[model samples]
Target: MASGMFDTPIVGVVNNLFGGLIDAPVVGRLVRRGLIKIRYVGRRSGKTIQTPVGYRRSGDGVVIHVMSPDSKTWWRNFLGEGGPITLLNFDGADRTGHAIASRDEKGRVKVAVQLG
Candidate 1:
């Protein structure tokens, strides 16, 4: 199997653990200090994907930095500057929002989700 195959499972396991902890009471608060969970449907496969991402609230929206823009395709779902997204906040509230993805000159991807 390719080397990338190994990372898939590890990432999934980590995400699951973080997702669970972020939904808990006390631990969730601590975890939310640096990460937030984002749930979005695949653009083509139509699968629901949930991942923990680093984010910060900006004005009326949240900003998430996508580490590598080219290798990751999930961010593509928000490329059109509009798409449904469920943001699992640190406070244990699921916030509905519209997400927009953009890439800077440095190749860093930034997703802005406008909360409803």
Candidate 2:
């Protein structure tokens, strides 16, 4: 199924719950297996936003797949290919990187980050 199909309010609640657990000690270790916490500054608001996203490490960078591209705006901040972001890796280290967002013909948004 397309990731967008799961972009409901209930999913947001569940994602938030997982995000909270991923910040804890033991639980975080388990939760980090499938999710990552991305820290980025809001483009317009200028406030720091933290959200849990599914990601995979590719070579020297990480790729994040946005479930609902149209409904989400965080990816917009990386459109110009120079947005700074922090990815909390499963190893418990924060990796600083620059990210660029792009969308496929299917409207799937992918943000690739090159670690610094």
Candidate 3:
């Protein structure tokens, strides 16, 4: 795996645990901040992919900052003209949106979603 600061074995385990907790029954509904799952089809493989990530509300939409972008491939599906996405919003709703992924000069990656 790539050597990003968050690309450690413990980090992966912690992320999985948190993902499970965030999606747990009853209590999952109470997670109204920080965590969310984004679903989208693989642009190349044509398979549906879903993963949990952190997000924050941005005006009329949401912004997902892709941590360790160099070590992750899921965000690449939204490159160029971008594509459709389904976000498991903090409200416990599957919100549809258009996602566009971009990388800045500093190598920070962000997927901006315009919820519909």
Candidate 4:
């Protein structure tokens, strides 16, 4: 009776719920420490989308590992070469970056971003 979080049906619900918590004024303070809000434009749809994901600082930028890659589509936008991205803290302070997504031989996906 235990369904996975990415098991369709409720993926959007989970994203919206977590996204709201990460963007909240008070609760976001702790959550945003490890999970910041990421905003990007869809390459094909030309629409702006915001999602909350876990990331860590890497050199001058940050690295985000996409969980259950097959269940997600956002990272695909950064495939091939890369694209412009904006990472925002709970306070709404954003850091602009260029993101390139790569996959290991094991099919694990991760996005390496260079902040500017």
For candidate 1, write residues 10-91 as lDDT tens digits.
7778778888887778788887887888888988888998888889889998899877566567788899755899987644
| TM-score for all models, in order of appearance | 0.84, 0.81, 0.82, 0.85
Between which residue pairs do clashes occur in model 4? none
- Tens digits of lDDT, candidate 3, 10-115: 8678767877878888777766477887889998899998778888899878999998898877888999999999986547578999999999999999999998
For model 1, give the RMSD to the true fold: 2.8
Model 1: CA > 4 A from native: 1-7
Q: Give the TM-score of candidate 2.
A: 0.81
Q: Which segments of candidate 2 are over 4 A away from where they belong? A: 1-12
Clashing pairs in 3: none
| lDDT (Cα atoms) of all candidates against the true structure | 0.81, 0.83, 0.83, 0.86
Tell me the lDDT of model 1 at 35. Answer: 88
Model 2, poorest ten-residue lDDT window? 1-10
Per-residue lDDT of candidate 4, residues 1-116 (tens digit) = 22366666676787788888887778978877788878999999999998888898888988999888977789999999899999976346788999999999999999999998
Q: Model 1, residue 116: what's the lDDT? A: 87
Model 4 gets an lDDT of: 0.86
Better of 1 and 3 by TM-score: 1
- Which residue pairs in candidate 1 have backbone atoms (N, alpha carbon, C) closer than 3 angstroms, thus clashing? none
Candidate 3: stretches off by over 4 Å:
1-15, 25-30
Best by TM-score: 4
Where does model 4 exceed 4 Å of error? 1-9, 90-92
lDDT of 4 at 98: 96
lDDT of candidate 3 at residue 15, scale 0 to 100: 68
